[model samples]
Target: MKNTILILFITLLSVSCKKEPQYLVKIEGKQLPISAEIASDKTIEDFILPYKEKVEAEMNTVLSYTPKDLVRIDGKLESSLGNLMADLCFERANPVFNSRTGKNIDFAMLNFGGIRAGITKGDIKTINAFNLMPFENSLVVVEMTAEKVTELAKYLIAQNKAHPISKQLNLIVEANEYNLTIHNLPLDDSKTYFVLTSDYLQNGGDNMVFFKDPVKLFKLDYKVRNSIIDYFTEIDTIKVELDGRFTKEN
Candidate 1:
């Protein structure tokens, strides 16, 4: 009887000491305004100065020169800046895609709004590439069917914006109909075509739904801004032209 009482007391004591689960009941937030009133940390600032100077020097390094301004708003159906962006991306990304897949990208496309800045007639610096493409969008190749290609053409026609397309494609809009040729050849419905685009567009960004759910997807692991920088580094002078790659009948 004594031992039973002792065992019962120990059980009760153990139960009483058990911890209950705690939960977050409420969350309060306070805004700390960053203003001149707040003191700067001199140690941190001093440590970062060298890195900042190095980065600025690299960004200002001259890559190439442009004789004329490359602006996105310069053309109605196609812009000089857009032409250069698309052409350089195609040129840089094609070899990478070809080496992996043994096939070439039919063309490259980018949104008109993607060109964030313009290049003035002067020495081009590394910062120009970053200013032109401010996003971290990477290159991707989507193998699309003829039906999707038609949808792409229709989307461009309806928008009537100067969305960038590589020189490999010629898109002409007449009335409600459009004509498209890839690499100087008519688009063949019997075969699938590979198109180079940013990963963002391939995921249906900027209302470009035709690039989503492609027949096949190939990621080149290359960023668009990097491609622009590389192309600029290779060439001493940059040239751009609309060249009738895309046109609309009046």
Candidate 2:
């Protein structure tokens, strides 16, 4: 009986030892370059060829033509490219917002940093639109009171950067006071204005806190990139110029 009990104990100890856990060993190395001498995988190439061809064809499709090059330059209160984009956004989004909410878009505002690239003086392709506004920001309308509109103007004056504003706005910065007009009229402190901008800006991007807590927020479900593409497709020739929409005087 003793010998049988001892044999059972030894068996249990052996099973527990066998069940001990093991750890994984890690090895790290730098990525190696892929050489042209590598054998091409025929199956993979055949699978990707059709998709590649379709993408190339779409990107190369001409949408419109620009008479002159529109560039985003530094230290300028406004640029041809910025004016063109802001005007296009307002034009495209106004009708949509009006139809949905029965209110017209008073003006449009966009950040200067958002304009990625300049449009060359030549045939404008779909790829150019994508390159200009790479972000997938959607169009949004913020209904703000007259007080908030004043805040908006102040923010612009303080920034003193070449941000894009629609033609509807005529802002003149004086030494201590700012003269702002929307649609060629003075801002009414009791009125509510529908301002068209990107969802990013509406959410306080670029320190535009005045856009926050608006009276009404309308999402247009329209991508800014798509709006540009639509505008280019509709117009045969794209003409843009700096018209001194926002000016400073001491």
Candidate 3:
């Protein structure tokens, strides 16, 4: 009987000691605005000065030169910057892909918004590559079916934006129908086409669903920004133009 009473007492004690859940009765938010009125901390600035200087020096290093400004808004259905981005990525990524799998990428595609900034008509610096593609998107090649390729063309025509496409592709949108040629040949339904693009697009980013669920995926493990940097380093001048890669008929 004594042991039973002790057990009951312990159980009661445990129940009584249990903490109740805390509830939030109200929520208050405060606005903190950053302005020049706030004084800089000298100690903090001194500590960061070396790193800042190093980064600035590295970013300011010249890579290549551009005779004219490369802007994404320069053309309809395609842009000079878009052309450069797609072509350079292909040029850089194809060799790597071919070396590994012995297969050549049929074409390259990238979203318009991927080009973050324009290259001014002057010396191209390392910072220009960073400014152009700030994301850590990697290069990936997807083998897509003819149906998926058609969907891709439809999406491009519907959006009617300057999505970056390599010179290998010739997309002509005419009313309800469109004509697409890869490497100057029409898309074959019996065979899959390999397309070079960033991992972001391969995962259906920016509503590019056609890129998702491809027949085969080849990851190059190369970053798009690095490709741009490498391309700039190798080339003395950057010249890109819209050579009727994509067109629309009225």
Candidate 4:
């Protein structure tokens, strides 16, 4: 009887002392967790999660490939000149022509070493693009002129095959020597030219000395990688296409 009374007393005391939740619960606005997505019937994980998983899967898949496939991947880069074009054209040479100036621009110049991987004879994946650029670069269009362009070409011609990364323009060679029109064309020193490129090239880190801006017109808020991703995504179902803009000539 005494034990029962003691237990009952303790239970009643515990119940009486129990505190309410300490949270100052406020009914703030709520959202349904909508997210930016690929917009498809296919299932997709979240940005960080799915991105992580797909990368892991590709990593594993690439690792298991045969030596023959590996050779093709490396061969595609070695045997072709796209590496040179992509390297020089895309790096610091993104051009946006202004209608006000009537200044026509050519293909964005980037160099080969900047292109770090091959397309592997299959659909290019997100990881493939990442491996290509791999740097924290953004597209910057700088206002330049025909004279500055001419000067830029002269500098490019002097580099020869010893150089790799592109600073302003893609150079195609005829027998390990470049004999091209874009590089030799006359440039007007008086006309303002807008060149699109990454900040890295603008800062002159890519050995592109022409990035010296008398004036900078616009800067992109997007990363170069994201821009590449968006660009590849919209290429009409062809995830990766090599036009061979950089061709071999005898």
TM-score per prediction, in order, is 0.89, 0.89, 0.86, 0.51
lDDT of 1 by residue, 217-244 (tens): 9999999999999999999999777799
TM-score for candidate 1? 0.89
For each of the candidates, give the backbone clash count. Answer: 0, 0, 0, 22
Give the higher-TM-score candidate: 2 or 4.
2
* Candidate 2 vs candidate 3, TM-score winner: 2
Cα lDDT tens digits for candidate 2, 188-217: 988999999999999999999999999999
Worst 10 residues of 2 by lDDT: 70-79
Please identify model 3 stretches exceeding 4 Å from their true place: 1-33
Error of 2 at 137 (Å): 0.7
Model with the higher lDDT, candidate 2 or 4: 2
Q: Report the C-alpha lDDT of model 3 over 1-250, residue by residue, as the tens digit.
A: 9999999999999999999999999999999899999999999999999999999999999999999999999899999999999999999999999999999999999999899999999999999999999999999999999999989988998899999999999999888788999998998989899999999989989999999988999999999999999999999998887899999988
Q: TM-score of model 4 relative to the true fold?
A: 0.51
Question: Cα deviation of 201 in candidate 2 (Å)?
Answer: 1.1
Best by lDDT: 3
Per-residue lDDT for 113-181 in model 4, tens only? 555665454465667567767887776666666666666555655543323323223445565455434
Greater-TM-score candidate between 1 and 3:
1
